[model samples]
Target: MPGLLQNKVAIVTGGGSGIGRATCHRFLQEGARVVVADRNPAGAEETRELMEGNDDNSAVSVVDVSRSNQVQQMVNDTVSRFGRLDILVNGAAILIRTPPLAEVEDVDWDLTMDTNLKGLFYCCKYAIPAMLANGSGSIVNIASMSGVRGVAYGVPYAVSKAGVIHLSKVASAQYASQGIRVNCIAPGGVDTPQMRGSTASAGTFEERNLEHPMGRVGQPEEIANLITWLSSDQASYVSGSTYVIDGGAWAIAT
Candidate 1:
Protein backbone atom coordinates (compact mmCIF):
# COMPACT_ATOMS: atom_id res chain seq x y z
CA MET A 1 0.00 0.00 0.00
CA PRO A 2 1.10 3.52 -0.63
CA GLY A 3 2.00 5.43 2.54
CA LEU A 4 -0.54 7.70 4.19
CA LEU A 5 1.36 10.84 3.23
CA GLN A 6 2.50 9.72 -0.15
CA ASN A 7 3.57 12.66 -2.29
CA LYS A 8 2.81 15.15 0.47
CA VAL A 9 5.15 17.90 1.60
CA ALA A 10 5.29 18.68 5.31
CA ILE A 11 6.99 21.18 7.58
CA VAL A 12 7.49 20.14 11.19
CA THR A 13 8.62 22.88 13.55
CA GLY A 14 10.82 22.01 16.57
CA GLY A 15 11.86 19.13 14.35
CA GLY A 16 15.21 18.98 16.05
CA SER A 17 14.07 16.75 18.89
CA GLY A 18 11.34 15.12 20.96
CA ILE A 19 7.84 15.02 19.47
CA GLY A 20 8.89 17.16 16.53
CA ARG A 21 11.77 14.91 15.60
CA ALA A 22 9.64 11.81 15.90
CA THR A 23 6.88 13.38 13.79
CA CYS A 24 9.32 14.26 11.03
CA HIS A 25 10.58 10.71 10.84
CA ARG A 26 7.03 9.39 10.88
CA PHE A 27 6.06 11.68 8.00
CA LEU A 28 9.00 10.40 6.01
CA GLN A 29 7.97 6.83 6.75
CA GLU A 30 4.60 7.73 5.29
CA GLY A 31 6.28 8.91 2.06
CA ALA A 32 6.26 12.66 2.55
CA ARG A 33 8.95 15.18 1.76
CA VAL A 34 9.88 16.90 5.02
CA VAL A 35 11.40 20.20 6.05
CA VAL A 36 12.66 20.00 9.59
CA ALA A 37 12.53 23.48 11.17
CA ASP A 38 13.89 24.25 14.60
CA ARG A 39 15.59 26.90 16.69
CA ASN A 40 18.36 24.43 17.39
CA PRO A 41 20.55 23.84 14.34
CA ALA A 42 22.37 20.86 15.78
CA GLY A 43 19.18 19.10 16.75
CA ALA A 44 17.67 19.75 13.32
CA GLU A 45 20.73 18.27 11.67
CA GLU A 46 20.44 15.23 13.88
CA THR A 47 16.85 14.75 12.71
CA ARG A 48 17.91 15.14 9.10
CA GLU A 49 20.57 12.51 9.66
CA LEU A 50 18.07 10.22 11.31
CA MET A 51 15.70 10.54 8.36
CA GLU A 52 18.33 10.21 5.64
CA GLY A 53 17.43 7.90 2.79
CA ASN A 54 16.45 10.00 -0.18
CA ASP A 55 18.55 13.13 0.16
CA ASP A 56 16.28 14.93 -2.28
CA ASN A 57 13.20 14.44 -0.10
CA SER A 58 14.28 16.33 3.00
CA ALA A 59 15.61 19.77 4.02
CA VAL A 60 16.33 21.63 7.25
CA SER A 61 15.48 25.17 8.33
CA VAL A 62 16.86 26.54 11.58
CA VAL A 63 14.28 28.98 12.82
CA ASP A 64 12.84 30.40 16.02
CA VAL A 65 9.10 30.16 15.30
CA SER A 66 8.54 32.99 17.79
CA ARG A 67 9.89 35.40 15.12
CA SER A 68 7.22 36.13 12.53
CA ASN A 69 9.69 37.10 9.85
CA GLN A 70 11.72 33.96 10.36
CA VAL A 71 8.56 31.87 10.34
CA GLN A 72 7.47 33.53 7.09
CA GLN A 73 10.82 32.89 5.48
CA MET A 74 10.74 29.26 6.52
CA VAL A 75 7.34 28.80 4.90
CA ASN A 76 8.58 30.56 1.76
CA ASP A 77 11.62 28.33 1.68
CA THR A 78 9.50 25.19 2.00
CA VAL A 79 7.41 26.15 -1.00
CA SER A 80 10.48 27.13 -2.93
CA ARG A 81 12.00 23.71 -2.35
CA PHE A 82 8.90 21.51 -2.51
CA GLY A 83 6.59 23.52 -4.81
CA ARG A 84 3.53 23.22 -2.52
CA LEU A 85 2.84 22.86 1.18
CA ASP A 86 0.46 20.05 2.15
CA ILE A 87 0.93 19.37 5.85
CA LEU A 88 2.23 21.20 8.90
CA VAL A 89 3.07 19.96 12.38
CA ASN A 90 3.55 22.80 14.84
CA GLY A 91 5.36 20.99 17.61
CA ALA A 92 7.84 23.48 18.93
CA ALA A 93 7.48 24.49 22.59
CA ILE A 94 9.16 25.25 25.92
CA LEU A 95 8.17 23.75 29.28
CA ILE A 96 8.67 26.04 32.27
CA ARG A 97 7.76 25.02 35.81
CA THR A 98 6.78 28.13 37.68
CA PRO A 99 6.75 28.40 41.49
CA PRO A 100 3.10 29.51 41.51
CA LEU A 101 0.92 32.04 39.73
CA ALA A 102 1.69 34.53 42.49
CA GLU A 103 5.43 34.01 42.36
CA VAL A 104 6.03 33.23 38.66
CA GLU A 105 8.69 35.38 37.06
CA ASP A 106 7.53 37.73 34.32
CA VAL A 107 10.39 36.67 32.08
CA ASP A 108 9.51 33.01 32.39
CA TRP A 109 5.83 33.54 31.66
CA ASP A 110 6.55 35.74 28.64
CA LEU A 111 9.11 33.31 27.26
CA THR A 112 6.72 30.38 27.59
CA MET A 113 3.88 32.12 25.81
CA ASP A 114 6.13 33.55 23.13
CA THR A 115 7.63 30.18 22.27
CA ASN A 116 4.69 27.87 22.87
CA LEU A 117 1.67 29.88 21.76
CA LYS A 118 2.86 32.81 19.69
CA GLY A 119 5.18 30.58 17.75
CA LEU A 120 2.29 28.39 16.54
CA PHE A 121 0.40 31.50 15.51
CA TYR A 122 3.29 32.68 13.37
CA CYS A 123 3.68 29.30 11.68
CA CYS A 124 -0.04 29.11 10.90
CA LYS A 125 -0.15 32.70 9.71
CA TYR A 126 2.55 32.16 7.11
CA ALA A 127 1.79 28.57 6.23
CA ILE A 128 -1.90 29.27 5.57
CA PRO A 129 -1.40 31.32 2.45
CA ALA A 130 0.91 28.72 1.04
CA MET A 131 -1.66 26.01 1.72
CA LEU A 132 -4.45 28.12 0.25
CA ALA A 133 -2.52 28.44 -2.94
CA ASN A 134 -2.31 24.67 -3.07
CA GLY A 135 -6.07 24.42 -2.48
CA SER A 136 -5.77 21.98 0.47
CA GLY A 137 -3.81 21.38 3.65
CA SER A 138 -3.70 19.69 7.04
CA ILE A 139 -2.25 21.13 10.26
CA VAL A 140 -1.65 19.30 13.50
CA ASN A 141 -0.60 21.44 16.41
CA ILE A 142 0.88 19.51 19.34
CA ALA A 143 -0.79 20.84 22.48
CA SER A 144 -0.58 19.32 25.98
CA MET A 145 -3.00 17.82 28.51
CA SER A 146 -1.97 20.75 30.68
CA GLY A 147 -4.18 22.87 28.46
CA VAL A 148 -7.28 20.85 29.24
CA ARG A 149 -6.97 19.98 32.94
CA GLY A 150 -4.20 22.31 34.12
CA VAL A 151 -0.91 21.37 35.78
CA ALA A 152 0.63 22.07 39.12
CA TYR A 153 3.53 24.54 38.86
CA GLY A 154 2.87 24.83 35.12
CA VAL A 155 0.78 27.95 34.80
CA PRO A 156 2.61 29.48 31.85
CA TYR A 157 2.98 26.24 29.98
CA ALA A 158 -0.61 25.30 30.63
CA VAL A 159 -2.03 28.62 29.51
CA SER A 160 0.03 28.67 26.36
CA LYS A 161 -1.20 25.23 25.43
CA ALA A 162 -4.76 26.30 26.04
CA GLY A 163 -4.15 29.14 23.59
CA VAL A 164 -2.80 26.65 21.10
CA ILE A 165 -5.93 24.56 21.42
CA HIS A 166 -8.07 27.59 20.65
CA LEU A 167 -5.80 28.68 17.84
CA SER A 168 -6.44 25.39 16.12
CA LYS A 169 -10.16 25.85 16.48
CA VAL A 170 -10.12 29.36 15.06
CA ALA A 171 -7.91 28.45 12.15
CA SER A 172 -10.02 25.43 11.37
CA ALA A 173 -13.12 27.56 11.17
CA GLN A 174 -11.38 30.10 8.97
CA TYR A 175 -10.00 27.58 6.49
CA ALA A 176 -12.32 24.58 6.46
CA SER A 177 -14.36 26.05 3.60
CA GLN A 178 -11.13 26.46 1.72
CA GLY A 179 -10.14 22.78 2.06
CA ILE A 180 -7.95 22.82 5.10
CA ARG A 181 -8.17 20.90 8.37
CA VAL A 182 -6.72 22.09 11.64
CA ASN A 183 -6.40 20.03 14.79
CA CYS A 184 -4.54 19.79 18.08
CA ILE A 185 -3.05 16.88 20.02
CA ALA A 186 -2.53 16.92 23.78
CA PRO A 187 0.05 14.49 25.08
CA GLY A 188 0.92 13.67 28.67
CA GLY A 189 4.07 12.27 30.31
CA VAL A 190 5.76 11.42 27.06
CA ASP A 191 9.13 9.69 27.46
CA THR A 192 11.50 11.81 25.44
CA PRO A 193 14.97 13.12 26.10
CA GLN A 194 13.35 16.41 26.99
CA MET A 195 10.93 14.78 29.39
CA ARG A 196 13.67 12.77 31.07
CA GLY A 197 15.69 15.96 31.43
CA SER A 198 12.70 17.72 32.93
CA THR A 199 11.96 15.12 35.61
CA ALA A 200 15.58 14.03 36.19
CA SER A 201 15.10 10.52 37.61
CA ALA A 202 13.64 7.08 37.07
CA GLY A 203 11.89 7.28 40.44
CA THR A 204 10.40 10.67 39.70
CA PHE A 205 9.45 9.35 36.28
CA GLU A 206 7.59 6.44 37.86
CA GLU A 207 5.76 8.81 40.15
CA ARG A 208 4.74 10.91 37.18
CA ASN A 209 3.49 7.78 35.43
CA LEU A 210 1.50 6.94 38.53
CA GLU A 211 -0.36 10.20 37.97
CA HIS A 212 -1.63 8.69 34.72
CA PRO A 213 -4.09 5.83 34.98
CA MET A 214 -2.01 3.93 32.41
CA GLY A 215 0.91 3.61 34.82
CA ARG A 216 3.38 4.40 32.01
CA VAL A 217 4.64 7.41 30.18
CA GLY A 218 4.01 7.82 26.43
CA GLN A 219 6.69 7.45 23.80
CA PRO A 220 7.51 10.11 21.24
CA GLU A 221 6.70 7.79 18.36
CA GLU A 222 3.33 7.05 19.91
CA ILE A 223 2.40 10.71 19.55
CA ALA A 224 3.97 10.77 16.08
CA ASN A 225 1.65 8.02 14.92
CA LEU A 226 -1.45 10.09 15.71
CA ILE A 227 0.01 13.22 14.13
CA THR A 228 0.66 11.43 10.87
CA TRP A 229 -2.87 10.10 10.77
CA LEU A 230 -4.36 13.52 11.35
CA SER A 231 -2.17 14.96 8.62
CA SER A 232 -3.09 12.22 6.20
CA ASP A 233 -6.14 11.93 3.99
CA GLN A 234 -7.21 9.09 6.25
CA ALA A 235 -8.46 11.81 8.60
CA SER A 236 -10.16 13.81 5.89
CA TYR A 237 -13.22 14.48 8.01
CA VAL A 238 -11.42 15.49 11.21
CA SER A 239 -10.71 19.12 12.13
CA GLY A 240 -11.05 21.79 14.80
CA SER A 241 -10.83 19.15 17.50
CA THR A 242 -8.39 18.47 20.33
CA TYR A 243 -7.37 14.84 20.65
CA VAL A 244 -5.93 13.93 24.04
CA ILE A 245 -3.35 11.16 24.04
CA ASP A 246 -2.33 11.48 27.65
CA GLY A 247 -2.63 7.97 29.05
CA GLY A 248 -6.02 8.82 30.55
CA ALA A 249 -4.62 11.74 32.51
CA TRP A 250 -7.70 13.88 31.98
CA ALA A 251 -10.01 11.15 33.26
CA ILE A 252 -8.08 10.81 36.50
CA ALA A 253 -7.56 14.55 36.85
CA THR A 254 -11.23 15.36 36.67
Candidate 2:
Protein backbone atom coordinates (compact mmCIF):
# COMPACT_ATOMS: atom_id res chain seq x y z
CA MET A 1 0.00 0.00 0.00
CA PRO A 2 1.10 3.54 -0.58
CA GLY A 3 1.98 5.81 2.35
CA LEU A 4 -0.48 8.22 3.94
CA LEU A 5 0.93 11.22 2.11
CA GLN A 6 2.11 9.37 -0.95
CA ASN A 7 1.07 12.06 -3.41
CA LYS A 8 1.33 15.11 -1.18
CA VAL A 9 3.90 17.89 -1.38
CA ALA A 10 5.05 19.54 1.82
CA ILE A 11 7.27 22.41 2.95
CA VAL A 12 8.64 22.19 6.48
CA THR A 13 10.44 25.29 7.74
CA GLY A 14 13.20 24.94 10.35
CA GLY A 15 13.82 21.48 8.93
CA GLY A 16 17.47 21.96 9.87
CA SER A 17 17.24 20.41 13.36
CA GLY A 18 15.26 19.38 16.36
CA ILE A 19 11.49 18.85 15.95
CA GLY A 20 11.56 20.39 12.47
CA ARG A 21 14.14 17.86 11.31
CA ALA A 22 12.12 15.03 12.80
CA THR A 23 8.92 16.24 11.12
CA CYS A 24 10.62 16.43 7.75
CA HIS A 25 11.81 12.85 8.13
CA ARG A 26 8.38 11.69 9.24
CA PHE A 27 6.67 13.39 6.31
CA LEU A 28 9.03 11.69 3.90
CA GLN A 29 8.56 8.31 5.61
CA GLU A 30 4.84 8.72 4.98
CA GLY A 31 5.74 9.15 1.29
CA ALA A 32 5.39 12.87 0.71
CA ARG A 33 7.61 15.04 -1.45
CA VAL A 34 9.25 17.32 1.11
CA VAL A 35 11.16 20.58 0.98
CA VAL A 36 13.45 20.86 3.98
CA ALA A 37 13.58 24.64 4.47
CA ASP A 38 15.74 26.46 7.00
CA ARG A 39 18.05 29.41 7.44
CA ASN A 40 20.96 27.05 7.97
CA PRO A 41 22.08 25.54 4.68
CA ALA A 42 24.35 22.94 6.27
CA GLY A 43 21.65 21.73 8.63
CA ALA A 44 19.05 21.49 5.85
CA GLU A 45 21.40 19.54 3.61
CA GLU A 46 22.32 17.27 6.49
CA THR A 47 18.66 16.47 7.06
CA ARG A 48 18.10 15.61 3.41
CA GLU A 49 21.25 13.50 3.36
CA LEU A 50 19.97 11.42 6.28
CA MET A 51 17.00 10.25 4.22
CA GLU A 52 17.90 6.90 2.66
CA GLY A 53 17.12 6.60 -1.07
CA ASN A 54 14.89 9.67 -0.91
CA ASP A 55 17.07 12.10 -2.81
CA ASP A 56 14.43 12.71 -5.49
CA ASN A 57 11.60 12.94 -2.99
CA SER A 58 13.27 15.68 -0.95
CA ALA A 59 14.92 19.07 -1.59
CA VAL A 60 16.33 21.85 0.56
CA SER A 61 15.42 25.55 0.56
CA VAL A 62 17.39 28.02 2.67
CA VAL A 63 14.97 30.49 4.19
CA ASP A 64 14.71 32.97 7.05
CA VAL A 65 11.04 32.81 7.92
CA SER A 66 11.21 36.23 9.53
CA ARG A 67 11.66 37.82 6.11
CA SER A 68 8.53 38.13 3.99
CA ASN A 69 10.35 38.15 0.66
CA GLN A 70 12.26 34.98 1.49
CA VAL A 71 9.10 33.31 2.74
CA GLN A 72 7.23 34.24 -0.43
CA GLN A 73 10.03 32.90 -2.58
CA MET A 74 10.18 29.70 -0.57
CA VAL A 75 6.50 29.07 -1.30
CA ASN A 76 6.88 29.97 -4.96
CA ASP A 77 9.92 27.78 -5.30
CA THR A 78 8.22 24.79 -3.67
CA VAL A 79 5.23 25.08 -5.95
CA SER A 80 7.55 25.43 -8.91
CA ARG A 81 9.59 22.37 -7.93
CA PHE A 82 6.80 20.06 -6.73
CA GLY A 83 3.98 21.38 -8.98
CA ARG A 84 1.63 21.98 -6.04
CA LEU A 85 1.72 22.59 -2.31
CA ASP A 86 -0.39 20.27 -0.16
CA ILE A 87 1.07 20.61 3.30
CA LEU A 88 2.88 23.26 5.30
CA VAL A 89 4.63 22.69 8.65
CA ASN A 90 5.55 26.03 10.19
CA GLY A 91 8.21 24.81 12.59
CA ALA A 92 10.74 27.65 12.29
CA ALA A 93 11.26 29.46 15.58
CA ILE A 94 13.78 30.74 18.15
CA LEU A 95 13.75 30.94 21.94
CA ILE A 96 15.92 33.48 23.72
CA ARG A 97 16.50 33.36 27.44
CA THR A 98 15.63 36.65 29.09
CA PRO A 99 15.97 38.05 32.58
CA PRO A 100 12.30 38.85 33.08
CA LEU A 101 9.44 40.61 31.36
CA ALA A 102 10.43 43.96 32.82
CA GLU A 103 14.05 43.55 31.90
CA VAL A 104 13.48 41.98 28.47
CA GLU A 105 15.36 44.11 25.94
CA ASP A 106 13.70 45.48 22.81
CA VAL A 107 16.09 43.60 20.53
CA ASP A 108 15.33 40.25 22.14
CA TRP A 109 11.60 40.89 21.98
CA ASP A 110 11.71 41.81 18.28
CA LEU A 111 13.87 38.86 17.31
CA THR A 112 11.70 36.36 19.14
CA MET A 113 8.44 37.72 17.75
CA ASP A 114 9.88 38.07 14.27
CA THR A 115 10.94 34.46 13.95
CA ASN A 116 8.32 32.73 16.08
CA LEU A 117 5.08 34.61 15.43
CA LYS A 118 5.63 36.73 12.33
CA GLY A 119 7.45 33.96 10.57
CA LEU A 120 4.46 31.65 10.96
CA PHE A 121 2.14 34.33 9.67
CA TYR A 122 4.30 34.81 6.58
CA CYS A 123 4.30 31.06 5.85
CA CYS A 124 0.53 30.86 6.06
CA LYS A 125 0.13 33.97 3.95
CA TYR A 126 2.18 32.66 1.06
CA ALA A 127 1.23 28.98 1.31
CA ILE A 128 -2.52 29.58 1.50
CA PRO A 129 -2.83 30.57 -2.14
CA ALA A 130 -0.95 27.50 -3.25
CA MET A 131 -3.16 25.27 -1.10
CA LEU A 132 -6.26 27.00 -2.37
CA ALA A 133 -5.31 26.12 -5.92
CA ASN A 134 -4.80 22.51 -4.86
CA GLY A 135 -8.39 22.53 -3.51
CA SER A 136 -7.27 21.28 -0.09
CA GLY A 137 -4.32 21.33 2.33
CA SER A 138 -3.19 20.74 5.90
CA ILE A 139 -1.12 23.17 8.01
CA VAL A 140 0.44 22.32 11.34
CA ASN A 141 1.94 25.14 13.40
CA ILE A 142 4.37 24.30 16.21
CA ALA A 143 3.70 26.11 19.45
CA SER A 144 4.80 25.53 23.06
CA MET A 145 3.47 24.94 26.60
CA SER A 146 4.99 28.28 27.46
CA GLY A 147 2.22 29.89 25.43
CA VAL A 148 -0.63 27.99 27.07
CA ARG A 149 0.39 28.72 30.65
CA GLY A 150 2.60 31.11 32.60
CA VAL A 151 6.37 30.63 32.68
CA ALA A 152 9.24 32.40 34.41
CA TYR A 153 11.98 32.43 31.85
CA GLY A 154 11.49 33.65 28.24
CA VAL A 155 8.61 36.14 28.22
CA PRO A 156 9.01 36.97 24.53
CA TYR A 157 9.19 33.32 23.61
CA ALA A 158 6.07 32.55 25.63
CA VAL A 159 4.12 35.46 24.21
CA SER A 160 5.13 34.61 20.63
CA LYS A 161 3.90 31.04 21.07
CA ALA A 162 0.60 32.34 22.41
CA GLY A 163 0.35 34.41 19.25
CA VAL A 164 0.94 31.31 17.17
CA ILE A 165 -1.88 29.45 18.93
CA HIS A 166 -4.32 32.27 18.39
CA LEU A 167 -3.14 32.85 14.86
CA SER A 168 -3.84 29.22 14.04
CA LYS A 169 -7.36 29.67 15.32
CA VAL A 170 -7.97 32.76 13.21
CA ALA A 171 -6.51 31.23 10.08
CA SER A 172 -8.59 28.07 10.55
CA ALA A 173 -11.75 30.11 10.83
CA GLN A 174 -10.94 31.98 7.63
CA TYR A 175 -9.77 29.08 5.48
CA ALA A 176 -11.51 25.87 6.63
CA SER A 177 -14.42 26.74 4.42
CA GLN A 178 -11.99 26.66 1.52
CA GLY A 179 -10.94 23.07 2.34
CA ILE A 180 -7.73 24.04 4.15
CA ARG A 181 -7.18 22.75 7.68
CA VAL A 182 -5.08 24.73 10.19
CA ASN A 183 -4.03 23.37 13.57
CA CYS A 184 -1.45 24.03 16.28
CA ILE A 185 0.55 21.83 18.64
CA ALA A 186 1.93 23.14 21.94
CA PRO A 187 4.58 20.80 23.30
CA GLY A 188 5.86 21.18 26.85
CA GLY A 189 9.37 19.83 27.40
CA VAL A 190 10.36 18.07 24.23
CA ASP A 191 13.96 16.82 24.04
CA THR A 192 15.15 18.99 21.20
CA PRO A 193 18.20 21.20 20.70
CA GLN A 194 16.03 24.26 21.28
CA MET A 195 14.72 22.88 24.53
CA ARG A 196 18.14 21.82 25.76
CA GLY A 197 19.67 25.16 24.82
CA SER A 198 16.85 27.09 26.38
CA THR A 199 17.31 25.17 29.61
CA ALA A 200 20.79 26.81 29.69
CA SER A 201 22.49 23.97 31.58
CA ALA A 202 22.66 20.19 31.79
CA GLY A 203 21.35 20.26 35.34
CA THR A 204 18.24 22.18 34.29
CA PHE A 205 17.74 19.82 31.39
CA GLU A 206 17.89 16.85 33.73
CA GLU A 207 15.57 18.65 36.08
CA ARG A 208 13.10 18.97 33.21
CA ASN A 209 13.38 15.26 32.49
CA LEU A 210 12.85 14.26 36.12
CA GLU A 211 10.00 16.72 36.58
CA HIS A 212 7.91 15.30 33.79
CA PRO A 213 5.23 12.92 34.98
CA MET A 214 6.51 10.33 32.53
CA GLY A 215 10.00 10.61 34.06
CA ARG A 216 11.35 11.99 30.79
CA VAL A 217 10.79 14.81 28.41
CA GLY A 218 9.01 14.13 25.11
CA GLN A 219 11.10 13.25 22.10
CA PRO A 220 11.19 14.94 18.68
CA GLU A 221 9.95 11.76 17.02
CA GLU A 222 7.02 11.63 19.41
CA ILE A 223 5.98 15.16 18.45
CA ALA A 224 6.54 14.39 14.76
CA ASN A 225 4.14 11.46 14.99
CA LEU A 226 1.26 13.75 15.87
CA ILE A 227 2.36 16.30 13.25
CA THR A 228 2.27 13.63 10.55
CA TRP A 229 -1.22 12.57 11.63
CA LEU A 230 -2.46 16.13 11.57
CA SER A 231 -0.95 16.73 8.13
CA SER A 232 -2.57 13.69 6.55
CA ASP A 233 -6.12 13.10 5.32
CA GLN A 234 -6.65 10.97 8.41
CA ALA A 235 -7.23 14.31 10.11
CA SER A 236 -9.36 15.81 7.36
CA TYR A 237 -12.04 16.68 9.85
CA VAL A 238 -9.70 18.21 12.40
CA SER A 239 -8.88 21.95 12.36
CA GLY A 240 -8.36 25.00 14.56
CA SER A 241 -7.50 22.95 17.63
CA THR A 242 -4.36 23.19 19.77
CA TYR A 243 -3.15 19.77 20.89
CA VAL A 244 -0.70 19.83 23.79
CA ILE A 245 1.93 17.07 23.71
CA ASP A 246 3.82 17.39 26.98
CA GLY A 247 4.17 13.85 28.33
CA GLY A 248 1.62 14.52 31.10
CA ALA A 249 3.77 17.26 32.61
CA TRP A 250 1.03 19.83 32.22
CA ALA A 251 -1.42 17.58 34.02
CA ILE A 252 0.90 17.33 37.01
CA ALA A 253 1.53 21.07 36.99
CA THR A 254 -2.19 21.79 37.03
Report how far off residue 45 is in candidate 2 (Å). Answer: 0.4
Cα RMSD to the true fold for all candidates: 1.1, 0.7
**What is the RMSD of candidate 2?**
0.7
Q: What is the TM-score of each candidate against the true structure?
A: 0.97, 0.99
Predicted model with the maximum lDDT: 2
> Which candidate gets the maximum TM-score versus the true structure?
2
Candidate 1 TM-score, true structure as reference: 0.97
lDDT of 1 by residue, 1-254 (tens): 88999999999998999999999998998899999999999999999998857498999999999999999999999999999999999999988777879999999999999999999999999999999998999999999888988578679999999999999999999999999999999898898876887787888888988888878889899999999999999999999999999887787767
lDDT of each: 0.92, 0.94
